[model samples]
Target: MSSFLTNSLKLLSGAIVAVALVTSAPALAAGGHGRKPVDPGFSFEGPFGTFDQGALQRGYKVYREVCSACHSMKLVSFRNLGQKGGPFYDPKYKNPNDNPVVKQIASEFETAEIDPDSGDEVMRKSTPSDRFPSPFKNDEAAKASNGGAIPPDLSVINKARNGHAPYIYSILIGYEPKPVGLEIPDTQHYNAYVAGSLATQWKGDPHHVPAGGVLAMPPPLTDGRVTFDDGTPSTLKQQAKDVTTFLEWAGDPHMVARKQTGFAVILFLILLGGVVYLAYRQTWKGHH
Candidate 1:
């Protein structure tokens, strides 16, 4: 019995170590122990808060010009952008597929499909219903292009990490020069917002550890890299906020609808409870 107990403990220890190694990489990449992200205090905050269409449009532009190069949003489609509550939503176009803007955006992308007449696979202009295309052909190609790091899909990236938008926002603008004493690899960038322990990489004072983490992805955004059509200044902060907003919308296209429904349900439940109470009192008014 004692021998079995010892073996069980050993197995548990081994499992714990394995799990740590497996999850450590993702944790490090994401902003785990890094500096807290700044709250942008977006317009879409409270239960009744609605998405800002202008910001969404600008963010989409930023994504199209910059992020779309490395990350892919496989879950979202052009039609989603014209949905009732989406960035380019137009009430005139009830069906997002019928939206002219959506059709134009979709046509810009080329996807592989089998031609009905020839039955041969060919690249064709994408339709509103098609999902966003990935930059790399496959995982191996993606890794080869990105220095062996497979960029995470951005479809649900906003929901993947805590403090979603703020976390993403901080990381984008968090690039900074390394401290005078500390040394980092040329390939890696020092972003204070990323989550990683740098004991192995830190050569600074033992008592004063570094404040940020390092990541393979360099500063993805630069001021004036993208020009907003709405005339919003292309500052780093604006770009970060706009892109974060777009990501939030991408991650939860039904967020506004979901919140509105929840509020209505709560109000309906309250009214129902009141009615039940009044009915019970009226039914027993002559008695107790």
Candidate 2:
């Protein structure tokens, strides 16, 4: 009887431990790489959805004023910004490359080129065709200035990572001070959405290991970091959402075009299916 009771108690204890682990697993694993991103309810989500031109413009402003300092968007050009699917597109302009706003924005930056007469490097005002300039001459230089961490380029970043648009938005707003008793490495900052791999890049102090890991990027966005020309509220969440939209557009400029094409194709197929069904029914009616 005593042996039976002891065995029963052991089984009960094991069952309790299993239940505890099952219940607490998600709680323990919350807020890391496993963390879920909040949906921004972006304008360009479903099959029929389209990008909001105003939001895109606001997002571009956020990137220009804040993210552009550290992140290079090498693939996007001033010309692309005024092209058909982009936010800045003007129906009145014969050629997007000749857009005055695009030209003005490009002219703000200096591009390096060989001077025809001197046969030497010269800095020249950019044209609409010119790509956005890199903040640093090279990766090593960027790393040296930013505490031994290389800032990733923003171009195609939305496509390169999982969670698509929300991931970028989440990382932008995920910054927080280190939790009590949690050791964060010097020169590193806390961000829940930051991938562990990005933290490993900052090999600053080997001894000053972060409790989980750290992001080399300091909190890049805050309330009112970039004031919108349209007077949208410059909250942290709003900034993050706006910048994410801009990056999404940059990664896939043809997204709207592609969506339109897909929709057209589906509609054509449906109509053809209906016509074919009618023809089949008529032909069979006479035979019957």
Candidate 3:
């Protein structure tokens, strides 16, 4: 009985160690500890807030000129650009496609289509109804082109992280020169914000602690990389803020409407509570 108990204890210990190793793999890869993002104080943060249309529009421009080259936004459609609360929303043009801005934006891209007569694939001018086309035809192609790294879709990126707006904003502007004495693997960029995904480097190196390692994506943003039409300064900081705000808007297009509805509901509940209290007091005035 004593022998059996000893064997069981050993097995349990082994199982616990295995679970811990599996769970800690990701943390180990991302250098185990890192700084958290500070809030950028966006206009759409509070309960009564709304998205800045100008910021969203500029953000869209930044995405189109920079991020669109690598990342795919498959979930977003061209028509969404002109919808209510969107950057290109125009009260004068009820139909999104009819809006000149949407039309011009759509016309800039060439979408893949099949030719009816030859049954061959052909490129044609895109429309407001079409989605933003992928820079790569497929994942394998994207990886092949970009050193085996697949860029994530940005359509719902803001919702994916814990501190959506701030986290992404931090990552955008976080790339820095690697610290002295820190050995980063080749092709890996130093980013204080990006928690890397793989842990193969940590294997067999119990003493070689992680100090923030490789990211497949090289630092993409640089100062003066894009020209803003709104005359916003073309600095890296400004670009990052604009793009991050745009992503926030994309992820929560109905945030303003939702907040408004919530306020109305709370007001109604308060009025109803007051009326109920008055009726109860009047009815029980003599009974009490």
Candidate 4:
């Protein structure tokens, strides 16, 4: 009876150990799951990187040309493009000379007075110092412009939205003409991941539409809208990648630095853990 009771208690202890191991496995796995995949275009290896500089410049051009007509980048300044350590920005940046595009855009705006001591302008050519002014002076005007579709600010948009790179890229590339034969309900949209809640004011058929339902904005980039200067064939995918990367940089210019710092800290901790483990083993030698 004594031996039987002892065997039962041992079996119970083994079962408890097995249960503890099973429960702890998931928690250990959770720590290994790091950041989600960002949009590929933002990556150096992306197709956009073939002409990264030109892509960034062209993206800015696109913003100035078409996107600015609707959306406002209230956070970004023109000077930020000329700042140090940015993909587009060159600290030793030179002004575009005789560039018809730049000239045409610059012609519309007037420069303000420069401060003498600071040598900086009180107002410049919608520079980095200047916040991107909205096309509409007020909310009422903005509503009047786009059938009540208030164009969101582009600044920090990459950060605010989830699924980051891919989401933006998908939004840009996902534009398709309404398909026939498929009857989409008014409530359901063509989202890869549907939203839990939608606004009451949302009109238009959600089906046969982009992922973000009720986007009043039409397919801005159909094929051949913008040509790639690098002799690579211009495609919507390339455009999406370029624009997404440009936006990603704008969203978090310091991501690379931050990632590097984080990696360094992690390495230090790992080394410290190893050293402590070794010391512990040495101290416990011959104890058990």
Q: Rank candidates, TM-score, best first.
A: 1, 3, 2, 4
lDDT of 1 by residue, 159-192 (tens): 9987688889999999999876778779889988
- The parts of candidate 2 lying over 4 Å away from their true place are 1-32, 197-213, 278-288
Error of 2 at 216 (Å): 0.4
Instruction: Kindly indicate the candidate among 1 and 2 with the higher TM-score.
Output: 1
Q: State residue 44's C-alpha deviation in candidate 1, in Å.
A: 1.7
Q: Residue 64 in model 4: shift from native, Å?
A: 2.6
Weakest ten-residue segment in model 1 by summed lDDT: 28-37
Evaluate model 4: give its lDDT: 0.60
- Candidate 1 has which clashing residue pairs, if any? none
In model 3, what lDDT does residue 7 have?
100
Cα lDDT, all candidates = 0.89, 0.83, 0.83, 0.60
lDDT of 4 by residue, 1-288 (tens): 999999999999999999999999777654322223335545543322322566676666556656778887767655556544354544344543233443444445544667898988685564334455667767788878877667887887777766666766766765444333334454333333222223233355654232233245666665566766566555777766777767776776666666667779999999999999999999999996
TM-score of 4: 0.62
RMSD of 2: 8.5
Name the top lDDT candidate: 1
What is the clash count for each candidate, in the order shown? 0, 0, 0, 6
- Candidate 1 vs candidate 3: the lDDT winner is 1
Best by TM-score: 1
